[model samples]
Target: MKRSRELQEELDSDSETAGTQPTIRPVFKVTQLDSAIDDELDSFAMRCNLPPHREALAFKTYDEYEVHYNKSHTNRCLECRKNFPSEHLLNVHIEECHDPLVTVKREKGEHTYSCFVEGCERKCMTHQKRRMHLIDKHMYPKNFFFAVTRDGIDGLSAPRESPRG
Candidate 1:
């Protein structure tokens, strides 16, 4: 009878603690008008569960760049150093691993896409802009080669065009 009473008291104490605990809820807000391509990118990011800001999207060759333009830029996982197609996939990884050692912080900025064409100082603000520059300016093929590896090295391939970046 005494053990039963003790167990009951412990349960009651747990209930009280749970009742007193505060719940944390994620806050979401939409602000201001953005470009349609930007909106599409945002939608894609959300769908993939990736952070909004990415550091770099470098390709060895303009051909590789052409291939990756339509797809999500791959990023290296800080914890495992493995490459993922998108930040969304990385976030999913964190969740799946339930890694206490891993931490993710969202900084304010859009994903950066760079032109790997040698001496062509073309750094696009968005992937879509880069695609436009490649197709319209450089006449890259509408269909291009997509690299499967995310080695994160920028200077893997030679530039097709003269220095225009």
Candidate 2:
């Protein structure tokens, strides 16, 4: 763990160039003892009959427990170091938050589609812009179901040459 932290610091410092955010995904190590304790604790939570581990390390502080829990039990986002309780939520987080970083690389260098709302003339060039237009201008919720494309809103016209955001 110490070695990994040192390596992460080195990577972060190297990547801290002007106008760029450090995007290194920090690695995590899950010890066998932690894995066993997590499994046993889940079983205990479900009211399953199980004996406590004789050698499980007792956490001393909230921070200790949180760190161990995040490392051993949670679906963690390495890029941002946020932990999700379930795999579905982790995937959703990746889709909504981190996936845009990849999609931005695929932009065609132009605005491809107009806003989905009726009577709205805003043209959006990327996934985040399209999403923001709906959320900010039309009061759409962050998790709104409008696909980032014209076909998603209305299929009345021919498809654009640009890809779906």
Candidate 3:
């Protein structure tokens, strides 16, 4: 979509070529769009009672949320009924303590990961294995990542995406 004249002018004003003709382009760049989405997500989280201390934090990329979630929230593990010293400690406990059974291989600078579903420890060590695992087990959007660390299966990339059942 085209940017409004005033917004375009404002953006052009910040450029090094101040006197040169401004190049009018789409108002929202990919990074800007991503930031907007993250803002919306933060708003949603806030409405859902995200703690006050976390409200001011900014998540730059969606994947960072995975890392953040893994690092934060160290209270009692609701699933395993385990208590931790702190929420952050509890989060670490969960990631380190639980074994998702997945494996990861680094070969020729490429990464090969696995799908360690219960009763089906299928290793995605090859192309065919990866496809079969995605189709037969995780039939979600193709863009989604399992977010399962090599052996630890306790963390999630997104709140909606759960560990293999």
Candidate 4:
């Protein structure tokens, strides 16, 4: 009842402020103290369906020591076959225990690049090889040029002779 009176006073003050700021009042009415108490009691009842003061329900033959021992002993390193002091130790063991052959068997192939020239089909295993291919097969000196000549029924065009001797 006291809480309800206090809440009513608060609502009245809020309504007074709502005249100047029409949006100040809450969209819904606040819960009455009696209903709030009832709701709390219902939630408490649901939570305490089991006895509040009683010890936790036990298994038919609960053995906590065996459970702990099994948990502590079962989590061990496969390679070392020894119980690790903690998960960090187990991770370290796994990282250190990898077989050399496994590393070799999982090796990745060397990096390679395709020639950047338009029609070139050469593949090189490194940048240096690709550069050499470009210089040897694609690049040309500035003076390099094909000479055009007039053909007079010859098999292939010969350089045009200097006009008249």
Give the alpha-carbon lDDT of every model. Answer: 0.47, 0.53, 0.47, 0.42
- The alpha-carbon deviation from the true structure for residue 135 of candidate 1, after best TM-score superposition, in angstroms, is 0.9
Q: Weakest 10 consecutive residues, lDDT, candidate 4?
A: 145-154
Clashing pairs in 1: 48-88, 49-88, 50-87, 50-88, 60-157, 120-165, 121-165, 122-165
Candidate 3: segments with Cα more than 4 A from true spot = 1-105, 108-112, 126-132, 147-158, 163-165
User: Tens-digit lDDT track for model 4 on 1-165?
Assistant: 244665677777877977664233344577666988776555432221122225433322236534534434544555545544344334433433454543343354343344444344565655456556655677633232111111111122331221111
lDDT of prediction 4:
0.42
Model 1 ranges off by over 4 Å: 1-107, 146-165
Compose the digit string of candidate 1's lDDT tens values, residues 1-165: 243565666667777788875443344667876688776555433222243325545455556655564333455556555544445435544433434432221123433444434445665664567667766777666553323122422333632222233
Against the true structure, candidate 1 has what lDDT?
0.47
TM-scores for every candidate against the unseen true structure: 0.25, 0.25, 0.26, 0.20
lDDT of 2 at 101: 52
Candidate 3 per-residue lDDT over residues 42-132, each given as its tens digit = 6533221233244456565656655555444345466565433334334444543453432212343233434434344554555455656
lDDT of 2 by residue, 84-110 (tens): 444544554565456665356446465
